[model samples]
Target: MDQEKVNILLVDDQPAKLLAYEVILKDLGENLVIASSGREALEVLLKTEIAVILVDVCMPELDGFELAAMIREHPRFQKTAMIFISAIQVSDIDRLRGYEMGAVDYVPVPVVPEVLRAKIKVFAELYRKTRELERLNHELEDRVRARTAELEASTAKLRESEQRRSMAIAAGKMGSWDWDWISGDWMWDEGQYRIFGVSPEDFEINPANVQARLHPDDVDQLRKAIAEFNKGTRAYETEFRIVRPDGEVRWCVGTAAATMDENGRVVRVSGVTVDITERKRAEERQNLLAREVDHRAKNALALAQSIVRLTRADEVKAYVNAVEGRINALARVHTILSLSSWQGAELSRLIDEELAPYSLGEQIKLAGPEVQLLPATAQTLALALHELFTNSAKYGALSTRAGRLAIDWQVDDELLTLSWEESGGPLVKTPQSRGFGTRSLLASIESQLGGQAQFDWRAEGLLCRLEVPLTRKTAAAAPGKFDTAGSAELQRASG
Candidate 1:
């Protein structure tokens, strides 16, 4: 279907006019030959086959009319198309003379660009069709002499194709079967025996045996499909589950076409059954991920609502800052969880992220074994650490250059014990009442994570101890509600 590009000859005495003609015909994707005079055009025509000629009628010597006459007189260019472009009005007598000189079309002083392109396209396409027909006539005679060899090659290719089809069916885990249900006759290929997990020597080719291998839930559905196929349905498709001999269940899909007799009765059915177990499993995993994402999104929204509801400060800006700080801490935890596929977050990473803004140097020391916290626990602990860091930057060990803080943790007796001690800052004093930060911190360890927190306000600084069970219970409090459930002794220990 791909045609060769033909040559379009643009002839004019003026260089600018020839350049303009080349620009207009460039997009036609044809080979354009430009000539500044009729003599140059004639030389080009003698060297190349021209399909369409655009000639300026007012050339200095051997003008458009004279040039067309000379081209038409040549035996090889007798039928070549010529279009004349004139910069002056042509009288009716001039037009008659131009037609006699082999001009097929003419344009006035100003040409309509679209009209000129349309006229040239028609002649070019006609020339291409004529050339193609001549080439086909030459090829027809040679085709008759090579027909026998082509037939032999086709036979060999068909045999190779059949072998490739069998290999493809096996590689694809697909099996083909033909069943004459009316006569209780069934035949299966090698791939079918593999799919059914049965050996041909031990398996009986019967409908009852096949039915027995189908899952009980899918039996009726497949039977209905077969019934429809037998009742004049030309094609039918169904998906079902099959239980193999070793108690392994697999998913499969069947596509079949019914062969009908002259009386419109289906005599036989043939089709392919493809194993779709892997595809089914992938779909199940995708669905599970969708549900998990939805659940986690709701939980995150609820946690944000809780931070907004529980946060408290004297000024509006203070309250907003408190809420934002806690939410930002929660967001960081979510980021860590996402990076780990929501499996968990490392305890040290969470601590480092919260304390990073404080710019703590050698004055602060940290010692802990690597521990991964669940999503809920990580969120709660991250918020608690953010509160602790905010307090230290404001009044505790990190408040002065001379101040010091040490954090350490260890796992013992199925419990993780983390201690935070501070020194060399303002004198410690216990608060008169528990604030939002203290209440949230207590709730995180006790209610949310099922742990304990004790704060000792010594004269030098503050020391806090937290104890959380390794196999902790799920959080008892829903989001948007920071549970205040704890022992009075623990409440008294809050600073």
Candidate 2:
């Protein structure tokens, strides 16, 4: 449907005239629509809009004058030009009649082809000019629509920009500022006033007023940063504390960039400051927790090293087994402490874990108040309990079928006292000298836990008492005294 390109219609009864017209107008480079009768010409007009019409005057039934009159009756062809071509001579009256039927020009018989071509060319150029004007009008309308859309978008963008600034301040919980050093004026938004713990009316809007709010300890550092900025530093960034007017201290971070003048001097500084007090406090707490974990880990490793150094064994396998057992007792204490987030461990729990191998039915009795020991104390007490169980198993309570053991403890204020008694076995006697297990047990209770240990060996059985403070941070506080149980002995045992 290219309206810019159109066809020329030729109506004649003979096929020869139609062929001649096609050959003559081939050089015009326009399409030619041919029809043999008035009825066929009307059909062509219905299908296509043509630039001009050329009709033969003498036809079989419907002649050129009749067809031209019919074309004039339709309003769609009002602007189309019609020409008459006859094969014979015609009278002036017939020519006048043809002009009355809307004929623009009359072509005589055997007319010159050039004259016909010249007439058709004029009308074709008019058609092309009309179509070109229409295309130009459509293009102009499209451009106007695009420009209007762009203007609407710019208006919306300006409105959203204001809203975006407010949302940014609320989400980030930060504030912006612009300092015009030339005017000595400071700009503070709502967020900035909140960070400084001041109201808009209370702020003086001057550099000196801002300087007064800076913490005394950090004022010099901020001054140095400002001095560097004034000297043309590209970036300004620092962290400092601010003492608000309400007497509250807060951590803040400042970042800014200075705008320079043509004279190479700082003219304005635009920046933001964020309140970071909560973040700083969280970081401090994390550091403290990490240090505490490191200290405890080191202490546990040192205690293992001490066990390896102090244990006396003849074979490598025996030494490893003994050390592994002692370390396992300490690990059990740690596990109990972990259940309470390392706050403390229950004394009864530690004792039960260490004596799990010994079935406590008739021969063993355990009685104690519910007492929670500190982490270090629990670890040391576990190993000491292990040594006590080993001693009773080998020579004291469990050596005979009828032997029995009784353990009981009581707490009074800061003091925790424990007693262990063995009976129903051979007559009790003290060793000639202290062995590795005996010395380790005494050192663990007295040196590590700041506790006192006393052993009494009677002829019938053995009795021991242990008294430790409820809260002893370190062994260096005070050493507990150990009393010797000087009695008879058949074996030099190490308990």
Candidate 3:
């Protein structure tokens, strides 16, 4: 049964009869509202939600039958149960009329309260159960939708991972092969045969023939790798040079794992082989390029020094200093580019490297979000920092041991502000004339970066600020990018 109280409406024309019914049904534990007339009862029903209605049939004007007919005509009250109560003896025709007016049952005057209470309890329980079932159904539908969405996301991730793996294998020119130790059977993929430079008809499919193809210098290494695999300490991985029939020497990487039987005896070995010939060639080419770059860099520095010497004069010292500073700035940019395979440099890394030599033990504060810079932006920034560092080392806070520098930057909308401040130096004064370094710094910021630069020669120390448009694509692809493996190989070859 529903724990909530049921609301009932009692309608009668006699006040004495209404009082008597209220006293009788007081122990029913339901909410009861009494109305004196059918018109008043209908008005109450329209304003409130009545679960059941008890009406008097023998009244004047709109009696119980007319009120019941009105309720039945309205679609809102179609489910409300009606009971007709009267003292008159109802014939078959009257009973039929009451039934046609949507009466559930007829109760005579002096009704039995227990019978009405029991019937209303049954309907209340049904309503409660129906509501509970509807709530559970809604929750079940929500859970199903959530689970289906999770399944779809998982499937999409799996498909993307598989596609990436397939692309990697194809791009790297790698293929898998298997060998049975007990049966002495060998199976090779097309890529493996292609890497070995052997036709299917010519392949001997034997261990001895495979060993003969490996370079003599790599035989010991190959044996060591196979020994490790047999001992179960690690998988087999060996790189060796193979001499093809067409007089080409190519490098290949082979990896395999041993499969053991139930008793731990070696049963088979399966792995993949990748052709690394192109990668090796690219490494060699990079080495040559690095050497060429180093030679040209030295030549360029020597040429700048020559210009400085030829133009040397007491009045031209500022010009010479500026030229040397710019040359050094170019060299620093080259160093950073070479380290990143000429891709780009991180702005924070560039700043730290430029200021490290001067701020050895002191606390050097940097405040900004980490940002990357393009090669052109890096060059311009490096030159500007070089000028600032040179000026500090010569005449600013960096000239003393008890000095500190703070570098900070911020980005707002399309503009970036970079500021440098120093303190704890000898009492400073404004310079009488701007030096070559200062003019060069200002010109570089304005012309190269399309920005403004300001210098404040305060009594405490020098302060420089720059405002620039931060419009360049920070993460765009560079022209000459090298992968990690290729860069490592090139470094080794160059060394």
Candidate 4:
């Protein structure tokens, strides 16, 4: 790159002296400005940045001292280099006065061209160096600010990551620990202290203190796991129980990894212990449910066998239909029980399900308070209801459009009394012999449910009243609702 030029101002009352000064400084490769008077020179200084100013001592209007003083007083030109040029010999006192007015050098008339060029070149180069240093300082400050901002952002991100890690560990009920096997040194974080149910101030962090809290039966298993880890095993896990100071037992699963030294010895161990008490309890409950389900399945199969064996049918089709109908009734009630987690079934829901096919306008009117029956009671009632509805559709109210079946139930103390009345049907007569359907209904209510079933064969219709003794287990079950889609509305008698 080429060197940049600086401006040098020449101020004289005579044109000849101004031309002489410009010619002498032209070979220095700097910009030279000419002004014929002091007033003209001041105007030039305002427009340009002059590095060196050469003014004549004998001026027509403003003398050298006066002009230099005026230039020095102006803020912009205070640091500008000024040299006085006089045609007459200057006394020492006059030179001192010129220096005080900011004259840097004095050049006598018939000045040496080489000496004047050397002085101006020094001052011009000094100004360029000062400006370059200021620019570099500004750049250094900017870089420092940018680096400081980057460090602050990185620190904030790291803090957020650590906070998230801590929250996850706490939520999972996990604790961490580190031990130096060689030095017998132990270290545990806050989570470890919390898991053991001991405060830091009350408990010492050592193997003896930790072992004292271990359940007697689980200590051996833990010892075996640690022994395996010491024999060059990188990973090992064990499940154990801990008895807290307050005698609360907690299940925990521990997993650890060992660091090996050059001699293949275990030097350090790091691990985590997680509370698994809830998981263990859930597993126990699942096992109990499995056994309960197996027992219930066998009972259902036995009930189906009994229905098939005792059913008296003249044809294969009759036998198949009777068996299928009873089985389907069992399945429907089973579905309801499953939906409620085998807790119980609602009495109203059971009635609605069995009467779904026969429901036509107001052909059936049912009124009952909300009642929940235990699993066994629900199953027996489902079969009984199926037999009643089948018998009605064949010979009773559901056989004709004009006939109607009205069923209602109420609970008083521990007994639930339900009445099934068939009105507007053919004239009723007492049967001499009981069929299998009537026998099955009577057996389910009396033998299985311990309830009484009374039949009234009047001239108009058959009215059956069932007095069922609800055990504490049955009436205490909480009432539940299931989706009985497309079922008729039953009258609910609030109690």
Candidate 5:
């Protein structure tokens, strides 16, 4: 389709005629091929793509009619425009033959130069336009194929990405939404309807519908947050509570950002929401436990200060020893408390921990059902037990070889009744004065633990009775814990 390089073949037997024809068509701005005979013309046709061929009728071997027939027989040359030039006058039969051979025109010898030039110009222009159209058609076909491939690839990537996003959102218990400010229509994915506890058919995701289900306290706060986001003041991030139709409350956290228009105005808001009710409940419980631990610390400090102030021993060393021993007893009760995550401690283990230093045999007997006491009650009773054991070992039952002590407790109704009595010891006598040991025990049992204790000075032994009120308040069983020792024989669930 190179316009400047279109081929034109000129065939004549005489050298003079060939020169004359070339001179006539030299100004046409096309490559011209000269053939001295029909055979030579066929060779030219084979080598080059010809737009037009002018052949002489009188030739030694192949005439103009024969050349035209050869050109028509080949498919590539079927559309090649052919013109025949005869030097002698043509017969009607010869003219018909030229026409039958696919000749468009027959030029006579002494041909008019202007008419021949005009005819060649017409065919040359037609050739240029035809090649140009063919080129354009090929280019269009290539472009369409490339565009189709691009679209197919883009669609595949989009489908793959959407599948991954849906899986991630479902696993995370999250939902996505889009709000168009101009249309006032909401668009939600499958996850959004599920998180809100609504079926897709019944769900009306509008501003009013959203506000209606929110907790009364959080509605205004969420609105304010969104308003600020629209005003270009802050990024949207907030947590709020939602009330379900069945009257259950759940917490949710939302975050959104705005898409801006060309004029820098808000166009749409897109965001995600997640259910966080369980996490919020856990946080509340942790805060309450922190406060309770702080209260225990303050009370323990006050009790220790009282112990130091009230001890009336004559020697400083004896007083220090007594305080140290009482504090260790309190620490043993604290061990069981930590094991149960500050829930409570078993009563029988507390008894064994206090009496471990003394010989644990028939001389010292203990019997009690498994009772889990509150941390405060355990701490108070641990100090009292320390005093009782020290007294029995020094001057009471355990002071003699045949001495025996029995400590037993039983729960009846809401009261825990405990008794401590000593027998098989030296003749018992009452002390002349009440010491810090007796006072501390009385104060801890009565004031700290909210319980009562009585002492009886009898001839055979000293008897002490304590009654404590049990309440039905506390947490469920602590996780990852086992019952303390000696609980297997006396263990029983609360009745």
Candidate 6:
């Protein structure tokens, strides 16, 4: 069919006869090879891919029958068709013997060339069809293999996508459920079982089981939400508490929407639930802390006003100004504590917040380890730093444009040491009288933090040093152990 020629082999003992057969088959449009004997024919068959063989019965070493039998024995030539030609009249036994040796047809000598050519043509066409069918079968098999590989790859991608989606839902603490009102069928995601604190196998798709888990006070609210959802008047959105079988109560928020039929009748309900117990508790704690902060701020302002009244002198303006500044500093510390939920404050952040009110130039140097101070310690230190800053601004280093303060702090051997050194100030001398600002600074550091305070007045400038024990209880405890009477005595002596 593809216009490719088929090859035919002719075997005989005489050269003239071989040439005559080749000339007869030349018009048949096939490639023809002529061999003078059975050995020559076999040699030709081995060299070329022959489709049909024509043999002469009488030969020298091997006859046509013997050659046909030999060809059948070889696997490569088993499908080749063989025909025998004889000069003598053939007997029935001779025809049967030729057939047994794999001959398909016999022709007498002086054969009709047209008939012989027609028979060879039939066998050639059959061989061509068999090869074409095999080619088609191989192509079909290759296509099937490619399609199967694509299907396998697609299946793997689908599995990977499902795994990622499931992981995301679990990590977000989201639970989903679907309920069919008509058939009473329910399907819950794995996260739903975890949120309810119930084993998946123990769950029943019934309204009674769901209602049983609700807290006594929350049952009515949950029922109301569900009733409203079923009536089609509203979607289900509610926050309620559920008591687990283990006697632990948890808060959960649930949202549901109904799937309605054409007539607006509810057919299914699908929803998600989330655990919000920890979030609710944190909000409650924040509210309580805010109220406490307000109370403490009021008490601090009252105490400042009392100090101004008791220490007032002929210089009323200066006394009021100093008292107001100190009170404002205390308020700023409280604001920082509130931002941190009263846990603590970063030492550096506290210093920056307190010094923002003063117009100290960038030349004021601060060096320290990064330390977190407790709320009480932050308050005490803020007050002490404010007093020092005020004193320097009025008469010490900060009063002059060229003056500078170098502040440094460190922790060594479980004690915190902070030193403030001033330079470029006028000649320094000890003050004759103890002032409220000086007294407050010494009292807060020594009494509240269980620390020592020392001041040295030198010709160059003033140097203030504080050494505080880095113990947890005295610095952070609600009620500290440092005696107020002893702190007052130390403040008077130091001032």
User: Which scores higher on lDDT, 3 or 6?
Assistant: 6
Error of 5 at 182 (Å): 1.2
Count of clashes in candidate 1: 1
Instruction: Provide the TM-score for each candidate, comma-separated.
Output: 0.65, 0.61, 0.40, 0.70, 0.63, 0.55
Off by over 4 Å in 3: 73-75, 91-100, 138-281, 288-495
From the highest lDDT down, the ranking of the candidates is 1, 4, 2, 6, 5, 3
Deviation in Å, model 1, residue 485 alpha carbon: 14
**lDDT of candidates 1 onward, in order:** 0.83, 0.79, 0.71, 0.80, 0.77, 0.77
Which ten residues in a row are the worst by lDDT in model 5? Answer: 479-488
Clashes of each: 1, 0, 0, 0, 0, 0
Candidate 3: what lDDT? 0.71
Better of 1 and 2 by TM-score: 1
lDDT of 3 by residue, 388-492 (tens): 776566566666777677889987886778899977766777767655455546655666567889988777877889876667543222211201011001110
- Give the runs in model 6 whose Cα sits over 4 Å from its true position: 1-49, 59-75, 86-122, 174-176, 214-243, 247-374, 377-435, 438-495
- Ranked by TM-score, the better of candidates 3 and 4 is 4
Error of 1 at 56 (Å): 77
TM-score for model 6? 0.55
Query: Model 1, range 105-219, lDDT digits (tens) per residue?
Result: 9977567777878888999999999988888977886796588679878988998898898988888899999999589699899988889899889999787899999999999
Best by lDDT: 1
Lowest-lDDT window of 10 residues in candidate 1? 484-493
Q: For model 4, how does the per-residue alpha-carbon lDDT over 1-495 read when each residue is reduced to its tens digit? A: 977788889999998888888889899888899998899999999999898898999998888899999999999888888989989999999999999999989988788898888877877788667667778888988988988888888888889887876786788788899989889898888778888999889999787888899999888876897789777899899889999999999999999999998998999999999988899999989999998898778667767766666666667776677678777887899999999998899989998888777666788899989998888888878877777777777677777898888999999997989999988776667776565566666766776667888887765667889888778344222111111111011111111
Off by over 4 Å in 5: 1-164, 229-234, 472-495
